[model samples]
Target: MDGIFDMLILGAGPAGISAALTAHARGRSALVLSSDPMNTPLARAPRIDNYPGLPGMSGRELLAAMGESLEEQGISRVTGRATAVAPFGGTFMVSAEQDVYRARTLILAVGAQQGAKPFPGEAELLGRGVSYCATCDGMLYRGKRVAVLGLGAAGEKDAAFLERVGCQVLYLGPTQAKKCEIKGTDRVTGLVADGEEYPVEGVFILRDTVAASVLLPGLAMEGGHITVGADMAASVPGVFAAGDCTGRPYQIARAVGQGNIAALAADAYMRKEQEKQK
Candidate 1:
């Protein structure tokens, strides 16, 4: 529990920034974790006119301003594609880039653009033969044949770990055809990529993120979006969700407002817990 942060936010866009700022303002230590090419959908937008006080600013420009605000607020941002999140001892442990960080509460401002569907049977075989964290599960498949589907740099790094762990690794880059299907009856025996078959014992689908439900196991979701209440609290206690991951509209202002609400809710949750301890 040492070095645990009060709040760990998992995005750098409007929603994440808003949440970090709010948590900081409320005297909570916060860190924003995100992967490279952060906030891509917003970063690539040509222009955003609807956001108040920043009319005509491109997504890049708006993000720059937000970055400055974060610096002024003393919020540290980290670049890592978190692949797993789990609850432990009433806190959360986030696994990313072969490292783990712990937080008392979490704010999920990650966008909804979770890339690529899982290969068939991948979800079912999770923990059976499919995995996301090589650092966590690579040893289980050590000295065995495994397939690494690298969706981001983390995948490449993890693949190397798999190799070092004595596994026969099949490294597949992101550019490889998106057509991947996991093959097995009870456990992953192989996979099919771009209509080609691979005889392997396991598959590691390394991406910037696993779905919220996959990350926490019990996070209630609807229509592929994380379900949140009026306060932006997810079905999972001690966690709040906002931004595009929550659902429709997907506007910058909506995301920001929801982020603010989520942060406020998170702050209150932490306060209540602290009081309980006292």
Candidate 2:
């Protein structure tokens, strides 16, 4: 329980599970954080006829195969929605419900993302201090301060990105304020355990950011598609989004393919960081 992971993959669909397998194969300690099966689009995708290696299979059948692979490989599966990512100390923090997951690197394999919450201030603050992509906002806090209200690899990585940008990051909760690592009046002042109030200029909420549907709106979305840069990475760093979430070719093969590439990019980034540490 005191150990930190080398990688934590989000979602347990084809993309996320694939990342977990890849990271584990490379000798990295990894975990897959996911919401319930009922929450994923795959659950609704009754038939799947496009995946390679499998001419025809139901989404459920494919999901089961992947699930079996995860078990066969001994990768831990944390069934919960990742609400936020942040940096705490030199490691990353992820928030989901009452649980807290940590890691050194992250892989966002959330495909066809969506937001499930419809609350006030949720939409207005997204990416305006309230962010989903840690790589994008991490640098914005250079030599400054920020607050991340999330848990798990997502929140931990987001906070790590903030730290990368020189931001004194404070972690809230993917659950609620009282259960957070940091708490204050209406805003986070400092780490609760440390009891030191650090000035904060922004607070990124992870509460409503789990599915591709929710994350889609905040991205460079046109109708439903996400615009990508040359490298297929989003405008955010440490955050390379692919799969159906990009809203481009909505096919199983494409999602699986993009997921593989994204995993590689994330792996490469983590390796680079490891090299720097060496």
Candidate 2, 1-278: lDDT as tens digits = 46788777777888777767777777778888877644466767777776778656778878889889989999999887665667666566877655788876556666655433333444444445555556545666577677776643456666666777677777765554433233344543433323444456566655323543343334455454455554446544555555666665666666666666766676787788779889
- Colliding residue pairs in candidate 1: none
TM-score of each: 0.86, 0.61
TM-score of 2: 0.61
Q: Name model 2 segments beyond 4 Å from true.
A: 115-120, 123-232
Best TM-score among the predictions, by candidate number: 1
Shift of residue 184 alpha carbon in model 2, Å = 18
lDDT of each: 0.86, 0.63
Across residues 85-166, which tens digit of lDDT does each residue of candidate 1 receive? Answer: 8899999999885788999999988888657356678778887899887888899998899999998657788899899999
Strongest candidate by lDDT: 1
Residue 246 of model 1 has an lDDT of: 93
